[model samples]
Target chain A: MRTDLLRRVEDRLRSLLAAERDLWSGVHEGAVVPIDALAELIASGGKRIRPAFCVTGYLAAGGDPDDPGIVSAGAALEMLHLSALVHDDVLDDSGTRRGVPTVHTKYTQLHGSRGWQGESRRYGEGVALLVGDLALVYSGELMAEAPRSVVPEWNRLRSEVMIGQYMDVHAAAEFSVDPRTSRLIARIKSGRYTIHRPLVVGASAAGRGDLAPAFEEYGEAVGEAFQLRDDLLDAFGDSADTGKPTGLDFTQHKMTPLLGWAMQRDEHIQALITEPGHTPDEVRRRLLETGVPDDVERHIGGLVERGCKAIADAPVDEVWRTELADMARRVAYRTS
Target chain B: MRTDLLRRVEDRLRSLLAAERDLWSGVHEGAVVPIDALAELIASGGKRIRPAFCVTGYLAAGGDPDDPGIVSAGAALEMLHLSALVHDDVLDDSGTRRGVPTVHTKYTQLHGSRGWQGESRRYGEGVALLVGDLALVYSGELMAEAPRSVVPEWNRLRSEVMIGQYMDVHAAAEFSVDPRTSRLIARIKSGRYTIHRPLVVGASAAGRGDLAPAFEEYGEAVGEAFQLRDDLLDAFGDSADTGKPTGLDFTQHKMTPLLGWAMQRDEHIQALITEPGHTPDEVRRRLLETGVPDDVERHIGGLVERGCKAIADAPVDEVWRTELADMARRVAYRTS
Candidate 1:
């Protein structure tokens, strides 16, 4: 069931994607350069985690494989996640993603090749923004096509994710940061959307009853663990493994695990953050130099372990436990 | 009848908004920075073109509001439209909207007061993105809740809008500027999504019989007129009247009615675009110094007149005719 589960999800996703392709039929035909490139980039190897989560959540809630609603909802979630990645890459000025040149980078190269100046950055970002919007619209459309009822979860999920994202950005802007605040930010930003809501949405769509509290508890714990794992990867992970630049979060002065730990133990970490004239890389290294301190690392390690354990021990069905166990282990030990 | 129509629509919108508000009940207290901001901004402003068109299309297709499925389907279109606006502001980097600070601008100001460096911009965009996402999800939820029969149209509408957005962005990235291409961009980017699909969705949702072709014809004509008017306004409209930054499209070298004309006529315009080195304003002034040629303006004026007339002449009900007539007149001569 476990091995077949991935195959099932991937097959459904492939078929859904073919249907979704019609959404951009004109542009894909018109401009062979950017539109086609973007489409290809989107369909390129994605973990499809959002879709998988949707599908998994549905199955865990006793949904049937033949249920077309699962396919639509899963596809919608995947589109939303992809859309966010497109926009986020532009915002972060990232040049590569998932081991390939990012959409902005490809467009920038195309613009340069065509000698289109001034609009290189603007065009890249603008096109990326539009692509993101398109994905967003399509996601909704796909979900709307689902056979099951989706109103209640769909309505609330939209608002919650947005609010959480806002909170994430706002918290990052703070010059003075603390652990409690950072945790709060993480919860809003990831906890509800990635784990909590997806599960609830899947369950609700499948007509499962009273699954909320279990999903909620598991989501919060595992969500925090997921974020904590991400922070570690950002600071210490191999770029080859993560497909992202190392030390990015630290360099950007993003308040994350390494900095949070350093700040708690030493005043010097504050000086490093407060001081001007340091490159993002320099700050990241400085924060790391204050050292994860065996005790601090241990603490973060404990939190992640505890969080994962809580998820594993939740009252969810055995499938959840099995699925979450793998995720937890990966989170705990993976370099990225 | 018109008064009642407006009141009923308004009341339905209020109820929808209320339902949406409740969706965020526990997680979103104290989140309404301007208590009536979204409601007022959406309610009192613009033509309720999307919703009305959707309803009209639904009715034309022999669908009925009295049919349990039509209401949510109609409302979903509105929610999707609302969500698009939230994200659009961020993409446009807009400040004021509907005679007030946009969502991003409002949030940015909130961060600025807190001494958050780069906080305002980041926070604003983040919040806006979140809000847009929320709208996207809610739109799906509404569709799912609606009577399941109209699902096909809802799905098609969703996909069409996204494709339209991608085309808009793709056209903006072009190095070679052509009037024809620009027109196509305008149609796909703004026309179909703004007018065509909304009308079709409305008629479809209402299950009106044999109205598809009429909606298409009416939507295409009106959509073109709407976009043409927008192009004229961008170039000639007073900032005070338009409530938008003057010459923004020109500065961005965006393909619009004004620039599209210039791009087609002059080699210098092509050179200016191809190798833009000077500031955007300098280029704008230089282009303007070539002056608004009577022939060029006349050409643009001709297109606008044709579009407006087409919309006015399209076969539809008396109520729609009057509305289209008023819109055409307003679009044809309005400064903004």
Candidate 2:
């Protein structure tokens, strides 16, 4: 059932992007590249985890599992995720995403191939930025089609994610390594948007606004676990499994809970954080010696168990409660 | 009356930004910087011409002059313009705007002063990009408050400007200096959003959707003249008068109609276009020798005349017809 819902969301995204491409192709040929870039980025593989969570939340709140509206709303969440990814790549100077060349990288290559004037880097970044903005606008357009009752939640979700991103980026730039700050970033950045808001938005769309508080509690637990898993994957997961090169958090000296824990264990670890010219293997080896990943895994297990308990206690249908619990486990233990 | 309306728009912007700042300050102190950056950028001076045009358009279509909705919608246009300016400064690597330091520059300075760890330039640019995105979201939020009937036009206006920007950037990158491409870029980039869409959106909000065709003709003529005036200011106006350094168009090899005219007069100017390391004075001297500025002035005169004539012929109230004609003249002949 989850796979089928994911397929529907994919279909909805493709059709929406196709219509946008057609509309802009009539405007100017140059306008088509950005749209095409967005479409390509979306076509690259993702777990569609956010959309799945949204669908499950809707189902738990008594929304029709087969409703096209629910699927469309889920697609909007996915599009919003893509928008963030495109901009995040630009921020990270990432060369690829999801095992494919990122939007900026692709545009940079296009600039070089065409022997374009001005700095190719500038042109590429400009195109990528505009493409990201376009994706954001399209996301809003899709959400505008959802039930009006969900509009405030949609806006809140957008604002929270952006604010969380600012906090995350600012902390890294400032070299802030406190565990409290790290956890705060995780809660606002991933915990809320990834799980809490989606559940609330889904519930609101299902005319189950009353269920939001309960879902928020459940979402907070699951979302924290989700981010913890993500941090672990960034540290130790295989490129083949995660579709991302490992140890980026270490290289960037990202202020993750794992990093904070490692720093506490050995003050020498501070020098390694965002240390210039450190190889990923060396950083990973040093971090592993601190046992931070194991500590994070234990925390993830506790949070997943807490989330399952929340779902069990939620005032939801028994079937959906069971499904939600299953989902919490899957999210907690997923390899990718 | 126009000055009073401009003041009201400014007041509206201040209140809105203040509310946003307060809301985010509660989220995380770090998130407040972007909001503050946006507020500072907006507080710096602008002509507020877009809002004026919107108001004029609303009144011409018989909308209530005292309605807060018109002012709110007009504020949305200004916010959208702010978003574009913030992003444009990042793309151009501009140091200042309106005789004040640009947002990225201010943030860069902050990073330096605070002795932050990461590359200051990267931090500044990232903050600016996210701030621009925030402003864009705020623009949409304001528009969502406008009458639902105008939502489609709002979407079109946003999409057209973004597409126009892509075209402009693409031409600059590809070194495409054709007159046709330049005009097309101007029409979509500035002409539509600046005058055409505001006029249409204001009219639609006033329940005068029937007047769209006539407003489009008037708006197109005026908006072209407005952009031409801007190109002239970029090339020839004093920094004190224009609040920006002169000859940016020449320095950047911006594909303006004036550049097209110069290329027509002296094909050798093509080599000089986007020539690296040439001083702005040298490029200005070469372009002036081509007499393109004078030709552009003549073109601006014709467009202003045509716009005024369209306003005269439009099927709106006679009183507003005269007022709009006067506006076209002011837009065409402005020094700054």
Top model by TM-score, which number? 2
Q: List the candidate 1 regions with Cα displacement exceeding 4 Å.
A: A15-28, A31-39, A42-46, A277-320, B1-44, B58-95, B101-115, B118-163, B173-175, B257-335
Clashing pairs in model 2? none
In model 2, the runs with Cα more than 4 Å from the true position are: A1-6, A64-69, B1-8, B65-67
What is candidate 1's TM-score for chain B alone? 0.78
lDDT of 1 by residue, A310-333 (tens): 656555688677786666456455
Question: What does candidate 2's lDDT look like per residue over B38-155, in tens digits?
Answer: 7887767888888888878888888876777777788889998998998888777788799998888888888889988777877788888888888888887777667777777888
Candidate 1 displacement at residue B184 in angstroms: 1.5
Docking class of 2: medium
TM-score of 2: 0.95
The CA lDDT at A306 in model 2 is: 87
> What's chain A's TM-score in each predicted model?
0.84, 0.96
Query: Clashes in each model (backbone N, CA, C under 3 Å)?
Result: 31, 0
